[model samples]
Target: MGVKVTGTVAAGWETVRAEFEAVVAAQPHSPEAQLAVRHHGRTVVDLWAGEDTDGETLSGVFSITKGAAHLVVALLVQDGVLEPDRPVVSYWPEFTGHGKERLTVRDLLAHRSGLINTPEGFTIEELADDAFIAARLASAEPYWEPGTAYGYHAFVIGALTGEVVRRATGRSIREIYEERVRAPYGLDLYMGLPSEAQERWKPVLEALPTPAQLEIQAAAGPMPELLPVAFNWHTDPPMDLVAYANHPLVKAQGPASAGGVGTAAGIAGMYAAAIGEVDGRPALLKPETVAEFAKLHTPGLDRVVSEPDHFGLGFERQPAVGPEAFGHCGAAGANGFADPVTGIAYGYTRRRFGFPGGPAPENLPLTAAVLKVARASS
Candidate 1:
């Protein structure tokens, strides 16, 4: 039977729905997923597909959590509580040495710190706790000279940045996010998934390779060095990502890097709140703050993830999508961002893992469709 996609699209956006259905049909495995878009602080697109999926269904949004984490950082910078040009060590004293004392907060947020992974890889147990992750990283050395080059910090950027947040304020990123962003804005995203909200979560399904795909993967041979480090590669016993989030410990601690659980509406709504007013509140960041954080911090070859495009501050900038579009794509084909030009906040999430991960290939058409509609509506 074909997958049933259910949801509502605002008037004049029926094409976006067709495009979303096209996206569902394009997936060979008929992945369970959710998508949402908010334009000018109003939700215009909300949809989902596959069994056990609904508008409120939550999933592990992989790295899209970075967008939430960094949004807090941007707020701090905006409030004068944190200075971008100052040394990271100023806030956290132990993050110095190994030629890293000179590294500024701007450089760290821009991914130029060269502190990608812990000297010793973090066990899933250790990885779940932001405090432990940050403490270990405090003494870790950088793979390259700080500020000279940029690479995706991947698994540990949140802890690195989160520790700075904790030092500057006696609160965790989750706490600040809840009080300032999630709670007030009524977003469905969670840095820490609460016990009461567990029922709403949709378990993420792994993308098992077909026989032919497995053959191709085996033939490809050795995985990239940084790739394994970033993902915390382990095969003596394969660790299940879904189980990790389902575990009571991880949900309680909510590791800032990738432990976020959220729905498409939550992610999109958060971004909408960032760029525009919603529910009678003001936009979170001023135009100057947005422009500053969105500035291209890394514009060339990325040494870590080996991607050509890196980020500005904590956001990955996609000029092709929009000059003002800034967000991050997660490991499980989830993506969220806000574009100032079109006043669009977008999010797409899937429980089933997508091939060659990182934003998945589906965002191109979905975003293009949304952009077309947004431009027309304006």
Candidate 2:
């Protein structure tokens, strides 16, 4: 292969390395991908295969940003800095204006707040600033009545939750992230990119679907029509996900919802730190905190994603077949989650957008491969 697979896997995980190579080899164009898995607090797999990319290249990890942002919430919850069941207006008084005063912090976390989008769709400039997003959304009535339904907040959940963090702690989530999680652990994931790390950023490539691809996607189950509304696509001009992420300003501001930039190792290491000891540090979340955060919060239909799955306090209970994993998947095929049972913290990144969006189809085999190795090792 022209683009070589580089990085190390622990001795017992050679098959994972082989699978990584096969994934890269099967791609028609240059596939830029990074995969990392930390097993039992040790990074047993670190590999990257693609052109113009090495292990350090940071990719825009769309909604996976939610996992990173919410981990901060989990930390504060562990510390009793905020209460999940408290009415959000208790933390930020302005939350009262839109009939949202009665909604609990847990309601927002479970995607039941109903403030999915606004009448005036956000420009990329507006989405770049979490405060502006929170402000605009603060007074907008929920698309559905609060607590009646759960939907993926999609573009604005983090901003919604981050605003609560700001009110409770008097610091933006980004700042708290720097002091508590990112800086302490030296994570390459950046909610806000500093000057020094700009050179390592890789702009994501948008993939246009072919007719065959479109047909296959339609066959898989029609893409949710309401997704546009959740993403603020009803206005005259709509958001282009690739353009939103690639814009220089967007990366700089690092909006809490979707502006996160990271490497696979960075994402993998983050989940590992949250649930398992890393380096010399203990896990950030206590066992009780983990249990509370991972418990099924959305058990009904997810109106935004149009799937019936469980959402747990902002983290996602991925699917039925995989190991009981919890974390967020992003728009451009980035998937990162912690399998608490297997002690596997996994992250995968791709610079190209996939047709069906969210996590790529390849993730199934990749996850299976990782879980198989992890279980065997355990």
Candidate 3:
């Protein structure tokens, strides 16, 4: 039997429901998925499928946390409390030395700092603690010239940026998010998952790849040397990303890079709040700030991921969604973004680790359906 999808779609968005149903049915396992979208600051689509899953269920959203972290940075920059062009060392003096004297806050946000991870990998415990991650990276040397290239700082971009936020505001990103963003907006998204909220949390399931998929991955040859290091898997046993995310301590600490937990509604709500009025409050970011942050800073091949990935200030350039769309994709088939031109905010989450990782293929078709309907309705 097929998984039953449940939710409401606005009158003009029937096609979105059809596409989502098709996508969910095509998954190898029950996707346990939720998808939500906002157009011009109003919720238009909210859907969920699979057992124990619904619009409110929370799951680890991996790198989507970067969006939340960088939103804080954007707010600070907008407020003139932090300057992007200023040297990072100016804010955190200990970051000097090792050819990093020239690195700027903008470089860190663009993933151009080249301080991916240490030669020795981190314990799962250490990965959860942003302060420890920041301290360790403070004096490290960049693998490449600081601003010359871009690479995924898979595990530490938040720590690096968060440390700066701390130095400038005397508050952690978590605290600031709660005060200025999440709490005020009543978003289910969380930087730190409280113990009381455990009941709403749904653990992520591992990927179930077919033999053909395994063969394809094997044909791609051995994992790149820096790949494991970038992923914090250089150690002998190699850190299990699934286990790391599932660990209670990691969830509790909620390291800003990859520890965010939220439902699709919450994630989409954040983007809606950023670019449009939400519940009578004005948008969090001004139009100029959004343009500045969403403009592509790294549009060529990424050194670590070894792909033609594009990055803006702290968000990935989702040209597939729209030229101006900006957001981050999670490792477990989650993606969230906002397109200022279209005035669309989108979020998708699944409790299962997807076969090929990163953003799932389903997003392409799903988003295309949404854009088509949105344009027609508009």
Candidate 4:
């Protein structure tokens, strides 16, 4: 059965609905998929399809959670609780180890810190234990000189950002998100999804690429050293899909870099709060903060993905789809971001796994569909 799509928004909802239905139909039996599109504070299209193995529940989105986590950092900056350009050592002096005293908060956010992966061969237990992982990070050396270049920090970025948030404000990243971003805006997202929500997590169903395909990807260009291989598993006994959905490393209060779990509606709600005042609630970022976030902080090929990626502050900008669009797209197929120019904030999460070498879908389809509607409405 196709995903039931229904929402109230401007005429753009029709375009969003058609595109979503088509995509869902093409990938029927996909574990779970959610698409939410908002324009100018109104949800134009909110839809969910398929089900968890247990049935009727939705899938857990992996990296799309990073978008929510990033927003928390932006909010902190807007409130003057965190300074982006300050030396990270000033906030967490221990992070200055291994000739890293020169690294700034902006370097970390831009993936220029050269700390791409955990050097300690982190296990699921270690990844989940904040103290253990953080200790390892402080003692670890950068893959390259800090601020000299850019590489996707992969898992390290989450831990680093979470630690900064922890030190600056005596609270967990999850707590700060709930108090400042989620609860105030009435969002249902969470970095650390409760045990009760475990029943709702739909596991990723798509198969990984073959070994030959992975080899091709590795040789394609500069790949992040920390990037996971085809069979990489975080759990001890190597539980694949289930572990990714329920593991502590994913569920802990790590900020926008990682550890976020929620639905499309939740993501759209959070971005809506940022783009406009939600239900009279205050904006998550001031105009200046948003402007700062939209400017290109890093523009070039990413060492991690070996693809051209742009970053501004904590958000991704000018993806291949549209120059005016700004938001983060995760590995696999998870997508979520907001565009202030057109007042479009979209969240699209899927459980199907698509690796780097396969005939993977492009990001432009979603953007093109949305922009068509946006242009017609104007």
Candidate 5:
């Protein structure tokens, strides 16, 4: 008979019972979610909830994939393949066009390259075509002076950094991630999720009290204009935003900033690997290298989100909405991050779509739940 397989952390299960329930209850139909926490290479919490499309339960995290993508770059740095301070134009010369010659790798990672929003008319599919997108960015002028100001690159960071990875290693970003990171640690995450694994994805239901509703809700509060129209980029018809997200172009192409798919378990495990070293295997980054990446480069009002977005090399720092976490969040409410201080890494994936600037704290609930587990474990 085949041996039964179980996760290593499932043994000493002291679940964050109430907090998890509160988070799950607050959201819409978020099927098949999982959360994992580890401290000093020891598992404290490994839990799963809900189901995927096939009724085989799982959770699908969205932009947290950016954090995973960042790890790939971290590995490159650790292996001496890439340097953060080098000019991006050195690797992809075409990037030197349009006043971007001076933009450094660190600028690209921190979303300060000034290539935000892809201009008005460019198709989202261009995001998948690195060369085409690079050319577009090359010819296009920066929305703001590169490195002088900050803006969330939104979708552009994925293409820009992914190109650097492709040019540096002569390997597809996905392949590099698989061989260097995922396979090494045995984590189930992907920049390009397989079609067969589509069965594992949950159908995200739209969250209630839409952005319009939130606007109304905020009218009663001190921050009435806090929910602005700028945040509603996902609603634009030209973008066909939802289709753009699920498109093969978006999936197969590595957008280190945004396009990624995986579970909370996978994401948390990957981050744990970053800090803990997987199964005694050598980490992709040295302790100092990780520390370097964690240094906050830009911390202030974001040009895109129009909020105080704290960014490290390629990770978001302690967001006002969550703990001292470092990871990326998605447009339609998905989040993944890790807290090295506490050895807590988490991924929360949900299918619910909502207008930006809504009442839903997006991934905050999951983050809060993870913090609870981490504190208990500590």
Candidate 6:
């Protein structure tokens, strides 16, 4: 039997529903997933599939938590509480030496710090606590000269930037996000999934790769030296990302780097709130601030991932969405972002890891369909 996709689409967006259904049908396995879109601060599409899943069901959103983490940073910068140009050591004293005294806050935000991980990797428990990660990273040496190369700080950027937030303010990034953003907007997304909300959360399913995909993986052979380090593979048990997110500690702490859980509406609502008026409130970010945070700061080959990637102030530029779009995608297929050009906020989550990871390929056509309707409606 086919999994039933159930949800509603606003008038003039029926094509989106059709497209979403087609996408689900094309999946190799049933994807227990949810998708949401908000245009001009109003929800236009909300859909989900698979057993026991709905528009409000929650799942691990992995690295999309970075978007929430950086949103708080952008707010502090907008308020003049944090200066992007200042050296990171200016804010966190211990984050100095080892030739890193000159690394600016912008450098950290742009993934140019070269401080991917400590010589010894973090245990799952240690990785769940940003404070623990930050403390260790304080004295850790950069794999490359600070600000000289770019690599995804994979598991530590949140702790790195979160530490700066703590020093500049007297609070954690989670606290700031809870008070200034999530609470006021009542967004379904959470930096820390509370105990009471546990019932709504679901575990992510592992990717069931096809025979051809297995052949491709077998051909690739041995992992690169940097890939394992970037992903903290030195731990005794290493780190199983799927298991890590499902762990209770991660749900409770919701480490800003990866431990976020929420519905598609929750994340899409966040982007909507950031870029447009929502529920009688003004946009969370000013147009100029959004532009600055979304603007590309690092371009060209990423040393760790070895791909041509772009990053802004802690935000990943979604070139596939639009020139100025900004957001982050999780190791699972989840993603959330705002496209200023179309005044669209989008979020997608799946309870299964998509093949090959990092922003599921389906997002391309899904986004195109939304844009098509958005332009027609406008």
Reference-based TM-score of each model = 0.95, 0.96, 0.98, 0.85, 0.82, 0.97
* Best candidate, lDDT: 3
- Give the alpha carbon lDDT tens digit for every residue of 1-378 in model 3: 899999999888889999999999987789899999999999999999987798889989999999999999999999999999999999999997777889999998999988898888699899999999999988887788889999889889999999999999999998998899999999989998987778999898889997888999999998655778899877989988889779888789889999989999999999999999999999999999999999989978888787676799988889887667899999999999998888899999988888868888899998999899888877
Between prediction 3 and prediction 5, the one with superior TM-score is 3
Q: How does each model score on lDDT?
A: 0.85, 0.86, 0.90, 0.65, 0.63, 0.89
- Model 1: lowest-lDDT 10 consecutive positions: 233-242
Query: In order, what is each prediction's RMSD in angstroms?
Result: 1.8, 1.7, 1.1, 3.9, 5.3, 1.3
Mind giving the per-residue lDDT tens digits that candidate 1 earns over 1-378? 778989999998899999999989978886788889999999899999987789898778878888999999999999988899999999999997787899999998988887787546767788788888888878778888899988888778899899888999888888999999999987889998888888897777778656776787789888666666666663335455566655666666778888898999999999999999899999999988888888787878888677776798899987657667798888888899999889999999988887656787788899999999999878
Candidate 5 — which pairs collide? 32-50, 32-51, 32-58, 32-59, 51-57, 158-255, 158-256, 204-351, 204-352, 205-352
lDDT of 4 by residue, 203-317 (tens): 5565556687679877877644445421233335543543555565566543344456677777777777887767876666777778887777777877666657567776777
Q: How much is the lDDT of residue 262 in candidate 5? A: 67
Best by TM-score: 3
Best first by TM-score, ranked: 3, 6, 2, 1, 4, 5
Quality of model 4 by C-alpha lDDT: 0.65
Taking the tens digit of each residue's C-alpha lDDT, what string does model 5 give over 28-54? Answer: 455334555566555665555443322
Candidate 1 vs candidate 3: which has greater TM-score? 3
Evaluate model 3: give its TM-score.
Answer: 0.98
lDDT of 2: 0.86
Off by over 4 Å in 1: 211-223, 234-243
The deviation in Å at residue 170 for candidate 4 is 1.2
